[model samples]
Target: MMQQLFTNAKVFTGTGEDDFVSAFRIRDGVFDWVGDAADIDGQDAVDLGGRTVLPGLIDSHTHPALMAGTAAAAECFPPAVTSVDELVDVMRAHAATVTAEDAWILGRGFDDTKFPERRMPTAADLDRVSTDRPVLVWRCDAHSAVCNSKALEVAGITAATPDPVGARFERHSDGSPNGVLTEIAAVGDVAAFIPAPSRDEQIDALIALGDELASRGIVAVCDLLSSRLADPLTTFRAAAERGLRLRVALYPGWDPEQPLADLDDDDREGRIRIAGVKVVLDGAYSNRTAWVHEPYPDSCDHGLRLVADEDVRAAADWARRNGVQLAVHAMGDQALDRVVELFADEEPWLTGIPSVRIEHATIVSDEYVRRLRDARMSFGIATHTVFFFAEYDGYEKALRAEQVPDAYPIARLYAGVEALALSSDRPATAWSGADDVMLSVEAAVRRRTYNGIDFGPAAAITAAQALMLYTGRARMLSPLENVGEITAGFDASFAVLERDVFTVPAEEISEVRVAETWIRGERVFAR
Candidate 1:
């Protein structure tokens, strides 16, 4: 491969200030050399016009395939529909466009807390849209869904049906299914009835998602669950074969029935790899089912636990024995505590595995932080502060006055954990613009919600520190090698920005545009 030099750029090496490089040489898709312009010999050089350059951003935890699937779904989120009537109107319009063959009307990104009615839409509300066809609109969090009567009937859920082990179908006082499904089990039961997307459709969606991520300067992501594809590995392979742009480290969604075996096959190469198995130990905090230590304020119910402790232990043991990483989705304090204890106890058995990760450690107490730090376990934390920016109102309603201050304490986690990473839980939090790394970074730095509320201001960090979480620290947690830094041995992937993120006001970080995104010494996106 010919050597290409990038010069006249302000480069943040992602190390400390002393490692800053003004020029770098790329050969064979890896950084060949990096140094000040005076020391570097220019050859086949491309002047960057003095633009700012950083390592291509990585979303340590996101669902690209899943978010792409919603491309065709109707938007029922705020600013689109602030009232129940408006929501029904949007769905009604979407329902009218559906053909007889595609009978179900699907929608996503609805938040009842922002609704003027201050309640979840019921089957009766949706029946007004269509009584003949099934209608399913998922909450912004994706942890819950409100289905129409036809959808409930199609899913075979009725008052006579017992609630799933760890999920619930919210009902009226008369004991009839009220069309609100909470948690994955309940939502999955109803969602299972929806026709699965074709393989071609899945590939198309993934390709589009790749382009979208590339446009946003994202060169790689650790996709937590590729979603309910017929075969996630095959689907990703098909996308990669078609020249999907972004690098992906996939962790197939956890299934209790499946054995913990390594699925990293021949196709596991530079762009795609089965990194680990992702399991959700508890539901999200937005839905008030995050398995917290204390009950949610104004309610006697302490959140729900989706997976049993024994099952988590079994999965952890299996992953350890098989030499694969295990990533658990534990959001609540109680859930996080249980995971810490489990890892601490299993420390003796762990050997060759890279790292055991805890996703969305949202509510961490000082004690929990100390326990994780003191255990001396090989662990990683993948968290998102964007939730605080998008869902502060909902969090305020769900948590107590004291609990609100500790929510999404990114700085605290950064101080306590060694392998702390940041991510954008896109589509989960429906802000004006979702899945943007800058938005997440800004939220972490500003510690302010969209409504201008100061949410745990003390937990805020500097822009550079926030950027490190996405670049340097994030790489330590994932299976991706030779990436996430502008060093000589790292992959030749980086993003040129319109403005210096380090000099911009924290609130203006999201406004900083990406002038170009390059991967493997090749330009993938430019604007």
Candidate 2:
């Protein structure tokens, strides 16, 4: 007999096509049965008083440990800047305060695209701020970084150094490395010289971030990378051992074609799990780096591929044979085209066969949509522009101008494919909550926002369909069992919705709230 019997709860089982808006029974950490209220055992009832019950939501992407690091730096946030002069003034004030010999003049929240003229902060621009100290002013995208001449000299980068394959080093016409370093590889090159937080410091940050996410009703997260840190394996493990209550799925790092023989298996007793290898096929399109079928209309850039496909195939085949899951990061249509071709024609893999999730199917086109349906590949999307672009514009403009309709294509997904997986690529601006999620859903379904602004509203999906994406869709994307859904033998994880997400007004959906969350049939979060 189960210890908890939630009665009178409206269980949203399955998704749009197979949804059952009915009651369910939970016993011994698994769903015993589901039916009308009359079918439930009254003897051990814990009535929910007609609240909505949904499968515990899953975030298919995030960098959990890096978030922990950000949480650690919250108090040190460099304040906002009003004008160019004001920005310099603020940095000068902060730099003067640090007495340490090698102290960093760190500041976030400068968007090159936002200024009256979309110009990057030059080394000269930062030198005015603090000539005496090393200044590293990062762009909001985190892709582009502007460092003062002092910091640039310390990095040992100059005109002769060729750009890292997948990254861009903004250069002087004289071919010298400009202060701006774009993308992960270049950022890594410069950051590689910076000292990382020690084990104890990282552990402390992880615990703090875990508390933050838990407070936001996030029970599980899938991290992309740990940020400025190459050793991601130790990051998650430290969280588990040091009082992290949230479940973590780490999906990062890949040496293309490298065998996962040294891979770690899931540690269920602990909350953290190594989801699998992450492969970056192409850079994102905004940087004009997403691998594509045709060259950009106005740019000579045909996009860039990080690793050759045959090489990736060898790795995928090896992982499939060995029981490792390969999470490929593909953002451009052309890159996706190549990946689909490879997946369709590749030989059956061997072992670590987990779900082949396509990270950031950002430009999910019609041809790609059909291919996605045909291959039944697991996919995850982060429609975070709603929050990410609160201050900055041009995201939608760039997409529309380029004739890309699927900036957020949930409807096309449900219509053309079977599964819908969602993620909040955190540290993108904000973290989780019903408000943050509902806004994305509205963008997915209503195709519009508060002011009735429309980007690609035609691509919007239904609420029922969207709910499934956040719930059981993760399992569909992976070979994992009983993880996404609540079934007879599945892990018992659920969230109680205070209001029906399907019926709520688009903008008001966030107004509805999370009442409680259960992980393994035990109450872990109560709102």
TM-score of each: 0.95, 0.83
Q: Which ten residues in a row have the lowest lDDT in candidate 2?
A: 70-79
lDDT of 1 by residue, 301-325 (tens): 8898999878887777666665567
Task: Assess candidate 1 and give its TM-score to the true structure.
Answer: 0.95
Task: Provide the lowest-lDDT 10-residue window in model 1.
Answer: 345-354
lDDT of 2 by residue, 259-309 (tens): 344554543224565655677788755445667766666556776787776
Best by lDDT: 1
Off by over 4 Å in 2: 14-29, 40-44, 69-111, 137-140, 174-176, 226-231, 256-261, 264-271, 350-355, 375-392, 400-402, 428-435, 449-452, 479-481
lDDT (Cα atoms) of all candidates against the true structure: 0.81, 0.61
